[model samples]
Target: MLIATTFSSIASAADETVTGIELSYDSWDYNTSTSSLEVFIDDDAVIVSLLAATSSSSTKKDVSASATWKSSNTSYVKVDKGVLTAVGKGTATISATYGGYTQNIKVTSDYVYDSVQILKNGSNAAESYDVSLGAEQVFTLSGIKSGASNENITTNATWTSSSSSVATVDDGTVTLVGVGTTTITAKYKGKSDTVKLVVTSPYKSLALSPKTLLEIDMGDDDQTIQAIATTTSGSTETVTAKATWTTSSAAVATVEDGVVTPVATGQTKITATYLGVSSTIDVVVRTPYQSIKLSPAKEYQMMLNSPGLQITAEVQELSGNDENVTTQAEWTSSNLLVATVTNGLVTPKAVGTTKITASIKGISRSIDITVFPSVTELTIDKESIDTFPEKSETLPKVSGNTFGGDTADVSKIVKWTVADEKIATIKDGKWTADAVGKTVVTAELNGLKATFELNVHLTPVKLVPSTKELSVVIGKDLALPTITVVNQDGSEEDVSSKATWKASSDNAIVVNGKVKGLEASKVTLTATYLNKTTTVKAYVEEEIEKLVAEPSSLELYPGKSKSVKVTGYYVSGKKVVLSSKMNWTVSSSTLATVNGSTVKALAVGSGKLTGSYQGKTLEIPITVSPKLKSLTLSDKSLKLSPGASYSLKLQANYTTGNPVDVTTSAAWVTNKASVATVSNGKIIALSKGSATIKATFDGKTVSMRVTVK
Candidate 1:
């Protein structure tokens, strides 16, 4: 078998001068004197490499892509850039030349099969296979040879099916034609193999019904359980009679062919098994009802001609479980003139007393109810009032008038709500305005509603500043102006701390009426309160000549990061750090990435970091090196089977930040290339032996022991 075939790394030559060359496959040297190239027919394509040795070094280099390749007999074998493929069973000569040097190797291609076998799903050896209805199964034909490698001949073999009506075979691919058993045969060269195949439902699992816990009342009819067999094709069939049914306790329940009969008042488990799949359910048998009781055991008082209340009837079962039988029970009222009841719903018709009864399964329960007269009209003290934001006031007093000409306070009992919460809020008889808006406050009681219009007014006509002009030096704190909001109703309010402040330029910053000078320039400041804005002129006085960045240069390893600080020097000997106000960028994104003033090195290269402040730009040269603090392999040791390959990852940890993946860039070497060879961190096991793999990068070295068997 061939393993680890990746062609992305091929078709490339080194920049070194070639002096001599040799051909190899899987790190195994090919000899043209005595050994001949042996290849199996219809096997995986093998890659041959041309290793060149330069005059300046003793080590051999890969020059396969730069070499010219040919096969003497194209019918026997085909060579494409050192990749050899067997087309027919014959002998051929493979030759490669590079830099006036040529090498030739003899190749022999044939199917040396000692035995033929059938594989299921490309791997496991099987004597029989199953194909679901409306589905297909692909069988692999493996030609195993003694003292030689095995090859897959699925496409090269001739396929035949014993029953064409049940299943059809085409190149080891068995297609289901009907539901029956068929024999599949594969003929490759002079060897043949056969495997039994069944085309049917291909049952996957068994589901039993009913799925819930079976509850049977004493003296009730017998219940039947069902078993459903689901196939792999998502088709289901009833197999209750075909399944094996058993009961856990025969004293409580007896089950025969999915039919269960309760024998006593107890619980038992019922199980059904079909086609190697089984499902179970709990069976419960007991006396259903012991006694029934109404939800409200005492008398209930309600208002007359109001909304009705639903009374539930709960029954205590013999199994110690409660069941709500409100709809199932029969409900009635003792006095129809006072109240009426239907389906456990009781409604009061008059101001009198009545008894409500609910009966279920010959068990009865009763509750006494008293109805009171409802209110006629609801009234409040005041209709509406005005308020402002952040102001609270007490709500109006409410009274309910009854038919008997009596009145009572209903302020606390009434439900209050505001139409718009953005305007105000009323809770516990206290109203507080949140913003300047108009909304209605509604109070509801006894099916009567009372609404009042509330208008929150805070309209500001003009904004006035305490100061008209201001001046401050760079790196100094600027004095902010106090603002006052003048309302339209001839009223004024100071809003210095509650206004949105902004500056027209980067020379100064204003937050909540606090200002700080950033550069030597003049800017306009504005303060806004309730949509009324006022302006003020501010001057940031400073004589700045140039800008400078600390640590004129930067040197960091890959994956390392740091921040650059920018400062401005004034001609008056005043210096200030303006890192946040400076716009930063990098010359090459492939070398480093800049976020604000922070710079992170990405790869090994040289670039320039530029920062522009107040029209003055400064460049800081940056150098990224591949100097690693430590290097290690992901696996300390590895064990692999013959003809198997594994990719090893090398982590290069730097002095700062996280490690980087340098697997493909590191130099890989193996002590025994014949046993195991490594290319760009991928190790391929050629034969059963041991080898040591080493990786070197950035003056750091790490090794791993590999045992292939």
Candidate 2:
């Protein structure tokens, strides 16, 4: 009998289970209930035959897969009839069920390919291409794998054109049909690449419309032309700007971007050429005007009731032909009371200006005539004065011919006015500069105005600083607050240390560029310069009293040393290490000595080691043991034969009554080295004689006699 059982366990965040199936041929989690499959684009389909089984008699056997295949998100990964395919880069839940048994396999698809390169005309394309309109190129798509070989995926990729109207692509074939630009994209799974294409028409021949061009006006505006380009297929298009255009004579006319401009009155040919085909058009360049104008002397100045000056005028034709029509033209003045024009002569009757109109061939143009004063002259006490806005000066005491002719002050009659009120204000013969710049000031009298430019600038202003607050630790110096100086032109400058400083309370003080904390209180720190003052708050903290040198007592061996540490405790229960800054001293130099907080043992004695810092002192008792009270030889006398050697042994006895071997370290001497020589704790017998051996260590010595027989 065939039986079905379901068993599951919580795997990671969610519960995924496997039942009634044998899961093998995998590396991770498939047999345990939670399994997933990973694949990339263009990957082979995975056959799920492992999920199929059948029961017969007393055994289960592998059978054809009859289970239905379904996917959670078909866009990511999908399965059809037990075959799984990857569509895009994402995850999908693929489930299969048959005969009351179900199994799930999460499939993840990823885009693993790195890039795609295009192959044009059966070869790899190293760069983009430009094709003519109606041309075609067979483009095969290639998907390049990262760190691997390039793959020809033209048949497997989907091809698309960004601009369908300009070009079209089908199965990797690109066909250009219009004169435009477009990008061809090749996609394989989720990886895609694009190549830009520009389609241009094959130009054949260039032709100009009307076989002529109209003359251009003399201004910034340019006139355009019409150019038709004919192709070899007998098709014509207006490719005016696409063709290069040139004038036969630049002195007569110029052409640019299909625009032709007339430079002088003449006839010239404009030629436009494209792709080795050229066409020419004859253009007449001329100006269009109504009548004549007088040159050189547009305006004439004449005294009242006097003969005027004679002027000349020139008339041009539609063909740009000029003629002197000065004597043939009739003239008249707009203001007859001020001036009169007879033929080309203008006579002034008053101190004013008149418009003189000249007519030729019934076409009219005007000129100007002015009359000056005969003897009047204007003078001023000051022509131009350099002053600021704070000072007020009267309008120039302008007097006209003060002694010789028409002697009278004309300052009031002048009526001065400034051109720009925002720059300077003028009222009742007085002016002020509102802004820093040069302004035009005019003095007018009897329709005559004289203009003068006045320059004004702002006065320099003092510096101002932004406010700041500071907090300092007890017995510490802190940097002063930043100060900025307000410049004359209303700008700022950093002058933190340049300003004079003062404190409101004695609890804190300012010195150099820093503020010193005195007592635990608040004080006002002020910075002043050039009548400007700015204040800031200074907060000072109190001193801490918790200084501790641990292990109030210590024991050390003779000639041995230890490092002493000193730490300060704050009110907030914080510790500050001060070993390097404290002064370390021992009561007796014979017992111990300290160098940089390290106490060295000198003798077997007790002494007081003191550490002093900032009005506080610390004392600790230090004792040195094993002081080497005496050094003695184990054998005081020895008898040896000639050529016999004996090793010496020495011992040091300390004040603590401890004995130690001082053999190799003890200083040894032999009074008669010929009899017995002591070297490195060993004595050698040389000849038959008596010798004395001595050993010394730690200010103690011992002697022994050796006899060689």
Candidate 3:
């Protein structure tokens, strides 16, 4: 067998230099030639070295060919190529010279009487040895009483095997060669010992299982291949996990340990090697296996009355495989109420969501489903449900008919939404009343919305009188208190109709939403709502003894304003400002106007500003004066030639106002048209003559003379 050989260390040596020569080996060196290189007979071989130039840190070099060797006492020791050999037991000196530099090595070969013994180690005794097959054995030999101290001699003990074909020994290490018998011996100084030995083979051939393999599809699970090794002694062992595995074509298949994975569509060989024996199997990786998928794998949606859609499943078959088997695929629905699938036809029903599944041959796929409602008609029997606070009741029924004429009772199925959950809530046709107030209750079914109002009547926790005081003109009625019904949760609601009202004195007044002014006497008004009562005070004013406009008199200019106040004197001698409460008007709107208590002057005229309440009326004397002093024409005279025209304008100069344009308001005329004609401040010339043009504004006139060109 061709054994692959592999070819470390500690040291104790001091370097010595002499003249220009350096001794490289510290184990054997000398100061001078007389004691230069020293070594023992049959000692571990050591090399004598000489270097002209070197450092201890330099890499050690064996330049035996470069140096000449010399030896003293050639019979006892010899030097050849710087290597000293002991031929007899004696002392000798060895030396080497290179490049004009020389170093010496002294040798001491001992001649001592010694016996040898055989052992597993401690060389010098064992020259040849045997080892059992399938194992490595170490042999040893020693010289008895050989040195001056009479110790075992181990150095320079040569080792060999009698039959190298059966066993081999290097130094003292022995390796078994075959299963056979042999003899081993150890010798030293004409003394020797022999031992009979035998070696056995522990391993033989390795075999792989599934000697022939079928083609495997790509993506197939990894497969394990078994390995078994047999010994020459007829014993077998499993080494699958320990055996090294390889694939001829890793692109087609790959093997790790004993597991094989098909990679691509090709053929490859798998080999398992154990104990130097290899076994192989063929592996073919074919295309992947066939599969199936639904057309809409993600999700599908359908609406009521929408055109029917066909659900399909396609089989992605392998080469030479069967065609699509959509017709044979089984169909199922997660919700029949939401949608239905029959013979691949998906018919949407009421609104909801569901999952549709398809199965064929052992493969299956599913689609997420959503069905929206299509309502043809929605109906609820009631507009509102009535319940007291903190009460419960069954909600009214609701029904929905789809466009497909399918009717469903949605009273319990519909989702209920409430504007105020504190007021009322509905769940599965059950209503829970929480507080007082009316809230809209909406029901949603089949995508259509329907609503039934919820009225949670306030349980009379307390009543609040919204009206505190009332002032009414004599013989005039006043609005009554708007009683607020408070619920148990400190909530208030206007429930005026929920309570009956009785006046303390019907002769004095009556209360409902209002109290009528029946008499001038004091009266008590009471309001009740939801069986809760609250009271308010009311006093009708006595008939007015006199009525007057405050400030007694007034004066204003045209197009000016004045704020007025009206006061009424009662029979009790009290005065009240009735300007806002009384109906206000002006005697002549053309002159002035009064809205509430404010008066506007329309022109330079006077009108009575009046205030009235409860059939009593009062008026104020007012006066308005014009602000203008005179009216004048812009041009005193307009001269024109016959066949020419001229225009004249009028202006009003005021006492307190800025000059105002009166041209548009002035009346224009010509006294003699033969000379010139004036119309609307424009003069047209006909014949040559003089004429007088008159402009009038607000009963005042200005004249101008004109001549035609």
lDDT score of model 1? 0.80
Residue by residue across 1-709, what tens digits does model 3's lDDT show? 1111110122223253222445555533333455444454554444665544344334444446767788788887877775766667677777776545556655675433455666764443344434445566766666566344544433445566677766777655666665566666665554555555666546677777876784676556888888988877879999998777888998888889888887667788998875446788898886543676777666765556566768777777666465555687788989999888876678888678888887654456788777655656667889867668778877777777766788756564567788898787766458888887899988775467888888777566888776555555556666665667777868877766665666677545564455677766566676765446777666677767777776776687787788888777887898878776666778887878876678878777666877766567777887987766788787777666778876677788876577888887888888897788878788898898888989887677789887655
Query: How do the predictions measure up, each by TM-score?
Result: 0.28, 0.23, 0.29
lDDT of each: 0.80, 0.71, 0.68
Off by over 4 Å in 3: 1-546, 551-553, 569-573, 580-583, 587-590, 593-596, 612-617, 628-709
Q: Order of candidates by TM-score, top first?
A: 3, 1, 2
The better-scoring model by lDDT among 1 and 3 is: 1
Residue 90 CA displacement from its true place in model 2, Å: 4.0
True lDDT of residue 165, candidate 2: 74
In lDDT terms, which candidate is top?
1
What is the Cα-based lDDT of residue 148 in candidate 2?
A: 88
Instruction: For residue 286, give model 3's deviation from the true position in Å.
Output: 15
For TM-score, the strongest prediction is: 3
Model 2 TM-score (2 dp):
0.23
Model 3 earns a TM-score of 0.29
Model 1 lDDT per residue over 459-571, tens place: 67899997666655577665587888888778998888878888999879875456888886878998876667999877676745778787889998787888888878877
TM-score (C-alpha) between model 1 and the true structure: 0.28
Model 2 is weakest, by summed lDDT over 10 consecutive residues, at 10-19
Candidate 2 or 1, higher lDDT: 1
